[model samples]
Target: MIEIDNISKHYVVDGVAIPAISGISLRVEAGEVFGIIGVSGAGKSTLVRTLNLLERPDSGRIRVDGSDITTLSKDQLLRYRRKTGMIFQHFNLISAKTVGENIRFPLKLAGEYTRAEMDRRVDELLDLVELGGHRDKYPAQLSGGQKQRVGIARALANHPKLLLCDEATSALDPQTTQSILSLLLDINRRFGLTIVLITHEMDVIRRICDRVAVLDRGVLVEEGVVADVLLHPQHEITRALVQESCPSATTGQRLGLSGPLFRLTFLGAVTYQPILQRISAALDVGFNIVEGVVGRIKETPYGQITVQALGDAADPARIAAAFGEHAVRCEALPS
Candidate 1:
């Protein structure tokens, strides 16, 4: 597990110190996919760099599996760093090198392997990333997704337990993004790798992350399970991110509902149950679903549906009470 304890970082510009991140503290459990999400200038990049000590913090400690990495000696840091790996938004491959050579870069830098051993490791990584056929191909010869696969392969060359992704899929289109994200998930499942990914997009967080931390203007605003945060966003920044992913999940006058509109959040078995129909029938009322977005968060099913109650069902408390019987949560959404 990785524990960030109140770490803070600042930069000096023209003799003035500007804070890049402040009192940021969070945890990434071992073998779990943890995501840090924020918009531009939110200091997400600074925070991720600090995890690997690429950008050192001005205060506080970083503990990886109970070891304080904040104050390691140069040699200790070098040995320590070999335990972690990093991926980037751009596929940072050496342009002149072939795919196999790019994957061999890190092992060669370690200088602990003979030529034959390095070759074996390179071939292993290419196969692991399912890029065996691209061993001799240069970066220019591959598509964006293929290039990223090679980058991921290179990152695993050191056999690192932890992988840090810095806006790793931002450079790809939606379809390619899904493919890369799926590959990451497959790697995590196959090897039990701990992944710490930072992105501004919530959809990326929703898709692969187990837990997520929300950052806004360098501060940790909120943190929770992916399902909880995405289904019921608490912070304004989080809500905005949700809006981008599912615009229909929004609550307001724009929905064009004349009756009382309530936003209903359903989970697990309740999501598939006929609670809404049964309740409306029992109350002798009718409801029109204004809008909704239903999806699975990792494994759990979640839905945020907007419905307008007509006649007797318009009683907010009664409507809520009826759904309570079936464990379906309903809230009177502000318009």
Candidate 2:
């Protein structure tokens, strides 16, 4: 639903151009959750802001469902933005407004609904975000998670076709973050809304993103399915991000295992099967797991294990072939 083509953005400081993002390009398919991840100052926020034209790129085109948003007229852009909603890291609700008013604010601004209609829509959004009982509460009276729920309810007030989340859950605790992510996922499935979110956490991407793009120093370093990128990261930056989320999966060398080490990747149904035990028994080889991680990427179960094959008869190529027959990927790792 969203296509960003060779977009570049820069800022002028002391009459010199400082790049925020350069030559970044990616796509977000309809009804999917796409995540852009990076460390601080990696231009993740800058890239996401460009989607809503909050920060217009210095060069290149941004097309949403086939229309070049970069070239839209001011009036046209205003109308376009109404169909796209944004949620922020810090809850951007009006302090004086109650939860109900905060949600009603968007509908009021759009001038597309009557007073009774806006009130009914506000109630529906409140219920959707599970804040029906807290509608009368002010921002100062709510918890961090509650405030964010209000922010989400307000973002969805106008029934946006696309949602832009800029560090939407970064400010919350782990439990709260998971709750918010679950809500976003439900929203995506229920409304078929396309979502583009930016975060510095790999765990967030693993939890909800269908695809992810890694950003580093204003460059698009890597991009792919969450399962593929998390299991076998191709870029150094991507590996580091994955390492932060699952240390054992990336730092197998630290395990201090003797003999030849191989990294085995299991996906889908194979992740649940006793592939290693079966392979070991069939080959008359003993398998010692040095380090391992088993978890799901979105809804797909996967496992990445670092193991050592024992016994003199255990040929590396032959052992790898045995695992391959069961739809497992085995790669020799440095000991």
Number of the top TM-score candidate: 2
Candidate 2 C-alpha lDDT tens digits along 1-335: 88899999999999999999999989999999999999999999999999989999999999998999999999999888898999999998899999999999989889989999998999899899998899889999999999999999888888899999999999999999999999999999999999999999999999999999999999999999999888889999998888898986433456666677889999998899998889889989998887789999999999998888899878999998999999999998776
RMSD from true fold, candidate 1 = 1.4
Candidate 1: residue 129 Cα off by (Å): 1.3
TM-score of 2: 0.98
lDDT of each: 0.90, 0.92
RMSD to true structure for each model, in Å: 1.4, 1.1
Q: Per model, state how many residue pairs clash.
A: 0, 0
Which prediction has the highest lDDT against the true structure? 2
lDDT of 1: 0.90
Q: How good is model 1 by TM-score? A: 0.96
- Angstrom error at residue 301, model 1: 1.6
Worst 10 residues of 1 by lDDT: 249-258
Q: What are the per-residue Cα lDDT tens digits for candidate 1 across 108-226?
A: 98999999999999999888888989999999999998999999998899899999999999999999999999999999999999999999998899899999999998999999999
